[model samples]
Target: MSHRFLAKQWSLIYVRDVLRVLVARDFKLRYKRSVLGIAWSLLVPLAQLAVMYIVFKEILRLTIPHYTSFLLAGILPWIWFQSSLITSSMTIVENRELVKQVGFPIAVLPTVTVLSQMIHFLLALPILAVFLLIDGLRPTLALVALPLVILVQFALTVSLAYIVATLQVKFRDTQYLVGICLLLFSYLTPVFWDFSGIPEPFYSIFMLNPMACLLTAYRAILLHGQLPAAKPLAALAVLSSMVLSSGCIVFLRARDRFVEEL
Candidate 1:
């Protein structure tokens, strides 16, 4: 019955309610202003897929098999991760008023931004299903692995958001740094090209990215109707866990000063 443990449990309660409220508010605000409303979520990812398909499949003459469906599989998760992280970086700054006033727990802010994006992503699944069907893809029991992929993705993203949001709040430059990291990491990841298609040395070097493992699983399930190899998934789980634990430690230390900084 330590006081610290009780305080943390209380904060977790606040976070759960706060996350739901923020998600609902974001859904309302995003669609309320536009005629097409939430359709934009589906459209945006579809447009990105179309452009990549045309550019890579047609223009570059890259003969990737089942390229259309494969791209969507990889890109949707990437878009979710990118969109969430970019928005989460500014979570505290955007809520500066709340930080200054009232005794709201600041840790909830990152979860809020991530949860809002999750709502949009869930709505986009039907659109993904349409394109997936058009590509002659059908459901398989292997699809059960998909949820595991999403769970790992959530763990990874939550950690990154917690760490980066804290840094962004403390040092303004960290915000810009996150943007730059995203730009560079996208190229490094196997979004446009598959490691399997490449020759040895380069493929070996590229597979080192943990996200490449996730991207591979996505393409395998969506295009090939197969499950991810357990080894890579295990590696990612370990790496993500380490990152997440470090993020929590950093957040806990920095959270104490957030109200004063704001």
Candidate 2:
């Protein structure tokens, strides 16, 4: 019975068109009257990389090779994950009026937020490539894994977004809570540091973080010019799939209550 209901709900014939329109609307609204427009997407992460480089590389002198490339590889994906979660958490609540309207799929609200932020993430990649080139690195065969890494991250991001969005409808504090968590997780995730520097049981524990594995994969492929090891990659794939499937089930079950809760 639940399977049949899920199929009916998932079979939105116009879902693609709706998603396209929502993504377009979000893009326009995001840059509506901004002077720099899309260039801000490139500049923001680059500016962040510059500051971190000076503080960590120059001042403190954390001796990671190709530091700039390493930072970009992690920062770009972290920005995507951060922005998607924050925005998607507020999606349904922000669109309460539309959500109340019949025929609206509440799930699409968070999905739109995820897709929109993903566009920004994709736009920032070329900047990462430029930094890599400036660091005297050329693309290698391992770069082929880049798309696979992105696919897994996207699944993970959307999965978490769905769950957060659903919960945020009832608990208005979820957005603020998500922001706090992102800040803490950013420092913990080895974005600026090397995983090898971590020690003992703590190192083993940090590996359990999905973002830790994904960021390591990005650094390995883009900065080190090598593919991530099979074991960690396989683990991340499985974790992402599990999260996506479970998140979808939770979102579908809670969706009908959104309007009532709002």
lDDT to native, each model: 0.82, 0.88
| Number of clashing pairs per prediction, in order | 0, 0
Candidate 2 structure lDDT: 0.88
Worst 10 residues of 1 by lDDT: 1-10
lDDT of 1 by residue, 118-165 (tens): 777777777777878997889888999988988888888888999989
For every model shown, what is its TM-score relative to the native structure?
0.92, 0.93
- lDDT value for candidate 1? 0.82
Error of 1 at 239 (Å): 1.6
Error of 2 at 155 (Å): 0.8
- Candidate 2 C-alpha lDDT tens digits along 1-262: 3445545655656788778888999999979999999998888888899999999999999989999999989899999999999999999888888888766666788889988888999998888889899999999999898899888899899999989998898889999999999999999898898878768899889988889989988988998889987698788788888988899899988988886888
